[model samples]
Target: MKLYIVRHGQTEWNVEKRMQGWGDSPLTQTGIRDAGLLRERIKEVPFDEAWASPLKRAEQTADILVPDQQIHVHEGLKEMRLGSMEGKRQEDLHPSEKKTWQTFWEDPERFQPNGGETYGEVEKRVNGFLEDISRTSSGNVLLVTHTVVIKLLINRFEDRPLRRIWEPPYVHETCLTIVDWDGTNGKIEVSCSIDHTKAGRGW
Candidate 1:
């Protein structure tokens, strides 16, 4: 099956480099425009089913991209809960914040901030959603979500360390990740994919 993993456009939190942490932040004006452009670009492809995170940013993007279609709101697709760090800029975080972020990479299983959910906690839920979707034989599926969740999902399909998967932050508004997962049913072996950020077609 063809999986289209897309990151939602810029939100106010995104521009501020704040950790949205499952918070419901409205999309920025730029975000709305980006979602609309994505609509026109993706309308050409025959999307069979739509899946989205329940967050407003992701839902808004999904709605603009695939209106009139009933969205399967998957709770497992949510961004990791930041607890105390929600809406706070990384720059404003305590010195321990950097250490915490680094610790998350070293060991996701037990790392946690004041009230932040560990990466391991997020993984379990995200994996459940992915397993459910992979059961399907064939269809075009789209997941509009936050940056951290996007990286986490990619890591699930491709065996890589969480920190490595999150090493890059070049994803712009309306970026698309084309992932190919076989229906063999157990684990996915990724063959090829593209980052449309560099595509110079005014997308």
Candidate 2:
């Protein structure tokens, strides 16, 4: 089976560099355009199943990218909950909170927000989802989700340590990542592709 994973397009919080976590934000106009462009880029791939995080940004992107397809809303695919940090810019964090935030990226399994989820917790849920999908789905599948979820999924696919998950290259808005899964084994085909975002007549 082939999995096509996508990070949702830029949202208002994304533009402001604010922590979005489980909080919701509408997509910016550029975000909508980017989603449309991404749709064109992968339209040739016949997606047999579609899934998305329940968050509006992800759901909206999935709707645009795979219209007429029933997208399964999976709570496990939602972005990591940032607790009190949601909607706050990095500079806006309190000194103590800032330290925690920094530690989170460096060692997510050990550091998490006061009431938020650890990276380990996120990995469990996402891995569970992947296992379920691999057991039941075939052909190509499209998963529209958030940045954190995308990173975690890729880390698991690559068998990388959870602590070093954040070290991977950043996932751009509406960027696509593809992986081939055969029940017990998986390999990444495309990491993050932004070719559709290029402005040209030949795109």
Candidate 3:
């Protein structure tokens, strides 16, 4: 089966540079337009199933991209929980919080959020979701999710260490990552491609 893992479109939090993990935000007009462009790009592919994160941003993107389909909302597809960091900008974080945020980008394995989930934890849950789909579905599957979730899935597919999760080619809004799953393993066909949108690179 082919997995079309897509990050949700740009949101209010994205423009504000705020921590949006597990937080909710409405999509910007550009975001909706980008998703529409992507929809036109991939409308020919017959998706057997559609899945999405429970977050409103992801759900909205899914709705815009596949309005004819019923999206199966799954908690495991949600973004990494950011706890107290949600809805706050990095500059607004306390000194210690700022340090943790830095660690998250520089040394992810050692980084710990105030009350958020660890990378390993997010990996496990997202992997479980993958396992469920691999067993129950076939053909093309669309998964609308967040940046962190997309990165973790890529790490799992590439078998990369948690420390290297923040590698290059950052996941931009509404970017598509295609994976060919052979029941157990996934091979990436495309990684963070936003050819359908006019948005700049980086998340």
Candidate 4:
């Protein structure tokens, strides 16, 4: 199974650089247009199935790309629940809090910010989602999700420092990542890509 992943398009919180953990927001007109262009790019991979976060930002993008595709919305695929920090600007936190945030970035397994969901919590749900998909699904699949979740997914197949995984790449609007999952041998190959954007002249 080639699991394709993508981040939702530009949003208001994204523009403001606010923590959009679970705070819901819709896509901008630019986001919608860019997503429409991605619909063309998605044709490159004839995905057999799709999964997405329940959030409108993600679901909307998935819907646009695969209009007739009824994707299963998985709570496990939701963004990290930010708790008290939801919607808070990066500057509002104190020096110590900021330091803790840094620590979390360094090693997510050992760090947990105040009023923040630990990476362990995220791992549980994410792993569960993948497990179910592996046991029951077939053919290539798409997952329309967030940056952090995509980072967690990558960590599953690669051996990298937590800090690097924590600092995920710039997942430009509609960017796609392909992950091959073979349940028979328990092997997976992950690759980050911007081909969708380049092919569609979305850059």
TM-score versus the correct structure, for each prediction: 0.82, 0.95, 0.96, 0.86
Error of 1 at 3 (Å): 0.8
What's model 2's TM-score?
Answer: 0.95
When 1 and 2 are scored with TM-score, the better candidate is 2
By TM-score, how accurate is candidate 3? 0.96
TM-score winner among the candidates?
3
lDDT of 4 by residue, 28-145 (tens): 8777877787778667777788899998899988988888878889988998887666787779867876776676667676676667778779878988888888888888899999
- Provide the global lDDT of candidate 2 against the true structure: 0.88
lDDT of each: 0.72, 0.88, 0.90, 0.77
Give the range where candidate 1 is weakest over 10 consecutive residues by summed lDDT: 185-194
lDDT by residue for model 2 over 15-127, one digit each (tens)? 99999999989999889999999999898989899999999999999999999899998988999999988999999998978999988878776777877888888878988
lDDT per residue for candidate 3 within 86-189, as digits (tens), equals 99998899898888889889998887798998887888899899889877999999999998899998888899888889996699999999999997788999
Which 10 consecutive positions of candidate 4 have the poorest summed lDDT? Answer: 183-192
Model 2: colliding residue pairs:
none
Clashes of each: 0, 0, 0, 0
Candidate with better lDDT, 2 vs 3: 3
